[model samples]
Target chain A: MSTLRTLGSAAGAAAVVGGLVLVATPATAADTATVSVLHGIPNTPVDVYANGERLIDDFQPGTLTDALTLPAGAYDLAIFPADAPDGSGEPLLEADDVAVPAGANATVVAHLEEDGSPTLTPFVNDASPVAAGQARVTVRHTAAAPAVDVRAGGTPVVEGLTNPDEATLTVPASTITADVTLAGTDTVAIGPADLTLAEGTSTIVYAWGNGEAGYDLAVQTISGMHSMPAGVPGGSAGLADDTSSLPMVAALSVAGLAVAGAGVARVARNRG
Target chain B: MRPAAASAVLGLALAVGAPTAWALTRPEPAAGIPVEQALPAPAAPAGAGDLPALPTVTARDAAPAAAVAAPAPARISVPAWGVDAPVDAVGIAADGQMELPDDVSRVGWYRFGPAPGADGSAVLAGHVDDREQGTGALYPLKDAAVGDEVTVTDAAGTATRWRVVSRQVITKQALPLDRLFARDGAPRLTLITCGGPFLPEFRSYRDNVVVVAEPVP
Candidate 1:
């Protein structure tokens, strides 16, 4: 769970960011991990810092950065209001000791929790190839909403998912109508929207924004994880026929005979 | 000299030399495994007494009840080609070409593609032969017929089956790059190797033999 605290004023934000700086390292370095940062807090543009170094300036709300390769480790991240005088104010939100693992592809989101408190949420993306004709859907609760049930085609597919948590399912690919309802209640909190689950893709849906202030949705797609049943090279061969290359054929024949001779020698040596 | 003696000498020559010819006609193995491992093992003497048989064991049957999850593929078998080879995950090389398997006796599974049992096209590629190792595990793919069975076994020992549907010989220069490397489509398995006329000038085969198969649901 993410830690959240209320601040008295913008000036007090700096004290909060300075209070935590845990020096922790990661366990392994087997593979490089890729990470993308998403800013989901409405109307907020932020300057992002990692380990006291400026990573992104003027990171706008509702936008996501391209995946960046990062070594597996723990990182300290802080977000300050855009254009704030350097080191003169507190960060709007800060998270320390975020653990990123090897071979992982993930997104670190700066979004508001239910009740409009800003927080950081880390999501691990599953990029493993999906079975044929199937698509994977993951719903993340990152909005200012209470625990909710996610419905796909009017049936409850994920139950009691609370803020900052997620649920995933692998189903046959299709366009599905999805909606979110408050837990134990049928009242729609957001959506009745159409989501296309393309074959061999993972469609991640984020329920963001403050519910009391009117909740909304954001979708991200990750693809290229599919398995074909057989191997067949597809495409057209440019040449009209094999006859255009006769000299090359002669060269191949000579090469073949030479190899045949060598094979005999090797076999005879092995026997002796 | 006896006819049998003459034939034996000829066969041996072909066995040793064929690998070099094939190697000259195909792309070299990508830098993944050691060069020696990529070469085929030498044939044993013909008159050696029958080797003792090992006990048969099935990984799936012996697995614990808690280990039923689908496992990552570890090996591939194309019965039609008498190929039972190890499988290694391969990534794109710095030159942007798909990296090939380090061992000629093994097949390289494109890491970017879905695992074999997953939906979409899973691609596996191998060398036709090696410069020092004759007849790689996938060498027999050139003669694979439609409806041949291909099996991929996962680390957990679960085996998924596929049946060959089509085979094509396309010039390398004209290969439909996009379609050949598609990530999403009907679940299919594609096997690739060098084929068609060998071009000495280019030191590569002019065409590629592509085999397409579908899950045997």
Candidate 2:
């Protein structure tokens, strides 16, 4: 089940390259949805074919594709080995009629199932703005591991999350230590790592790799979804009452006096 | 301190003594166009079979969930304020300001934010007063007390109830924009309108009355 033990660091390097792609292409049309591709099969470099077109060549494992904004539609996807000649051999994995919704931000991950079979999973990224002082955390179980319980601060936050499944929760923005254990058992499987949940953002943690070889974790962030009133800032200072504030009352009195004085001046001028 | 005093003294000199300027304005709700038109087109209906089955989760747990997609608000009602108004979806204008509802009797739901019952704070704004119609639908929010029930009905007729948790009047400059517009958190609703003394000079109200409510139960 653990075929690509040596390719772990290479996958991390590919992710860095993917991050650069994301920074370079920041213009997405309003009507389109942003779709990113993640190659999770360890130790394998492959070419990705979408709708019969070779979209990515020599795509390394543990790497991500820059988000592509495409019109909402169905596209056939196929994964071919890196050395396989284009259009010549059988695909390593394929999914037909993969649907991409309009205006949704999503990640399609090609990873191994718990049984060590390769599969594709499409996850819709929640782009909804988080409330002030809050963040969203999502845990995706994509490794070849048993059903697991995800704990935050030593308590189970998500339980019975098996491979290719995910659980999400909204939490106060803070740094938390999280660990994964086998479902209903305290035996730790991965992590005592610090997870930073920043305000108005979604932090997605993926558990990858086989448990026997020690599972690995990857983090991805999608930000800028913060819910605030249209025009108000979150840190606004508010007035206690309308009429009683000393400054307000004083200002009103001054204005009243000014208007009265203006009236007197106009009357005097008329009499003159 | 001197600058602050100076500004106050100057304010008196320039005070025109006009009626308080109500900040809320009832612009004609985008002129006969459908309010939902301003929002992103609804995503394509997802096919049931497209999603893979969870390894050990039961069929019931696998059923498509309500939280997957937020439904657009169709109406809003505040029982304590005697407000029962149709909701008009409003988006940000070309000037980057939120568009106001055209109908003085209706409330404008910020379409860019989460829907009323979604995870984030859904915001609804209305005019305090209209030139011809007098008080706007949300004008009574000034008196909204804690525990008042605010119900939002989605297009699918699912009604979610919220209870007022806090209410305050804040100057426009001090308004918490992000909190009012947040799209993720414990589901909440924010009601806002013009408040405080109207400034005729600026032709707008000086403060905003904000009512924050959390989901019931």
Candidate 3:
């Protein structure tokens, strides 16, 4: 595979192939949904189909697809092992009657069930506006291990997170040291890595894999959804007005001269 | 000492007590801006879980990341208007609006938005005029015409050029915030300043002078 993976949309965020970067465009129109796919079952590389059409080819574990804009509705989804002939075979995972709401940002993942069986789970991503200098971070558990607590700076930010469930937090934008510990215990399960939460973005982190196979994280980012300024008070004086009279212009030149004189005097004082 | 020198100069200008023009366009270094607030504790956790075990991430654990990072903009200029100004990063102000620098000579880039050369609208705002000073760095923006060229230089000294495509005088209430501050779209440059009749009672301009520029590929 080439080192560079290109997202379909020109406006879409860039996606990192085998690591942790996936930027998405939020769905804002009322009739379409923005959706992405994450292949998270360890060592299981598969092809994904939606409504009998091939959507993702050779989708590998720990990788996330770019956001797809689809009309709001229900669709059948099927997954086949990589290189399966034209979606004709027994499927590894199937989800029927999956409903996608209009103007929603969502991600569907093929991950491990708590008992170690593979399953398909759909999650609606948060698309609400964030304040300036703030970011939204969402954590999803898709592994087959027991519940765990998510910690930032050694303190629990999320408690008792189980498989296929997710938690979200809106916090100031900064690089944070994060780790996952067994629920109510100090046993480190994952992390202690520094995650850069950029301002005005939603960063979704997925914990996927089974205890037997080992676990890993994949990150998806959604940009845009920053609050507008109350107002831009850019002009305090009316001098920029185009309709100023001749006298106003003359006075302005006088003021300019006075300012220039003041500047000269200040320079002289500095020399002294 | 700098403050005293500035006040003395300002005092002389005020003593003149004459009508002011939009001069003082030289870009000066931004000063007295407050430090950004520290990141607070994460907001309350929301949503439910399905399954999970912890995952350890390290430099050795994954493939090398190849994502592109845009440099921060340091200055902006327009040859058409003879305008040059320092760029300062600003976040939300105390009133929840985009913040602007106290000095009119420097332009404030909306730090939360996409940076220039990124695939989204990169917004920069500057004062059109100030009460203490005469004209602002962006005071000439109201007269901008289509085809004018704008150049933004990043901290790394890379300069990106843009061509003015449109200029509008929209009432503050009617400003289209969605397009002006869009997060996903073809990369563009958006410049803003106050315009229209100045309301002495409210001490503000009634409208915003918005200039949209497309990247010069």
Candidate 4:
């Protein structure tokens, strides 16, 4: 319980300034997934690679994640230091043969050992997929779960699942609309997902992270997120609009000041 | 006078070219204080039941730093939200973050909240401690109830009053989202802090209790 509270506090701090946090949702036909992953390693950047391509590179530990939509299938995942295959100057820790069933959301764990050997584990649901629209998918902990490893489509997205207990990943878009095939239980374990991405069109993954602290935190969170229609460019844009008009006004004011100064000087010269 | 003379010289030279706008180098910090001073706590909010009292000074130690160093806060009073505090003037931090007063034993302005005339809710956050190991201002903020009062006097310019209407403690997983902090109602103020249970080993609060108030008529 104290651990939960400590984790909660840490989660709160990250949520305040870090970025978005995804929780689990019930798996339904039209369900969105809430994918959350955490790189257990602290202060270091970890590159999350899936299908042999870097999804989130140099992702600051503790807060890299995404909520994705998928029809589901087998995929590959890898974990390495940001300056991978060289910087960490080591071999890749691979969590291959990851099979996410149709419509159901799966959570994988990627833990890098002291020696940099990364391990991946899976939690597959058994329930059948819904017949259409949005379904709720919950991602939770397994009896022996290590940490959280999240991916979007076929790419590795989020990591460091500190508290999947309260968050869920929003499932991304998939081609099919019916129920998703599951691996085990009918109910998803985490929470609920938000937003539904269109399947046909290629979509980039974004993460709502709490622990990622650095430059790409914003972009990682945005790129790792499941693009919700409204969450897209709105409030910040409004603020930008207000400030965008400032430079021009400041320019005009300065120009006016200069012109007035020129006029006064001319009048003085005339008097002279 | 010297500034005007310099301006005259520059103005005459500008006629020979498309002059660049004057860009002043950002200001630096005063001595004896950290560039990012800790957030301070405001006086007890109005309508709030007699607040838990804090250690009082003899008004002796507050010299030098109180006068030319910083803009004194205007008297602040909130009838509905239980705030009758004063606000001091402050400059933006060197890093561009809002710089609250270094005293964290009380509720202080969060500088990042809604700026003056912002359409949505504004923010003001402070600490409940005066030290890493001691409790200070806002220590009892989690005890603040809904409908209390919170007023912020922009001593640099005007005195704006705010009323407390809601108070909640949310875990980080469930952040007080844009809906709570940036509401569509009258311009409001939401105060945040890490409170509830103390995780001593972690040196942090377990939950963030948010106290929300709005402008009263």
Evaluate every candidate with DockQ and list the scores. Answer: 0.03, 0.05, 0.17, 0.02
Ten residues in sequence with the least summed lDDT for candidate 1 chain B: B55-64
Give the best candidate by DockQ: 3
lDDT, candidate 2, A152-215, per-residue tens: 9999999999777788899866778899899999999988787777666888888876644557
Model 4 regions more than 4 Å off: A1-272, B1-102, B106-113, B130-133, B180-185
Better of 2 and 3 by lDDT: 3
Arrange candidates by lDDT, descending. Answer: 3, 2, 1, 4
Q: Which runs in model 1 stand beyond 4 Å of their true positions? A: A1-31, A230-272, B1-217
For model 4, what is the alpha-carbon lDDT of residue A266?
63
lDDT of 3 by residue, B7-76 (tens): 5567567545444323343222111111011101223322213211111111112211334456779999
Better structure of 1 and 3 per lDDT: 3
Q: List per-prediction Cα lDDT, in the order shown.
A: 0.65, 0.65, 0.72, 0.38
Rank order by DockQ, top first?
Answer: 3, 2, 1, 4
- Which model is ahead, 3 or 4, in terms of DockQ? 3
Interface RMSD for all numbered candidates? 22.6, 16.5, 17.6, 28.0
lDDT accuracy of residue A78 in candidate 4: 60
Local distance difference test, candidate 2: 0.65
lDDT of 2 by residue, B1-217 (tens): 3443445445555453322321122111112222122122323433334332211111111111122335789899877778899998876544445667867688888765678767666788877775556667877766776678889998999998988777777678876675566555567787877776665455567777777777899
- Model 1, residue A122: distance off in Å is 1.4
How does chain A of candidate 3 score by TM-score against the true chain A?
0.74
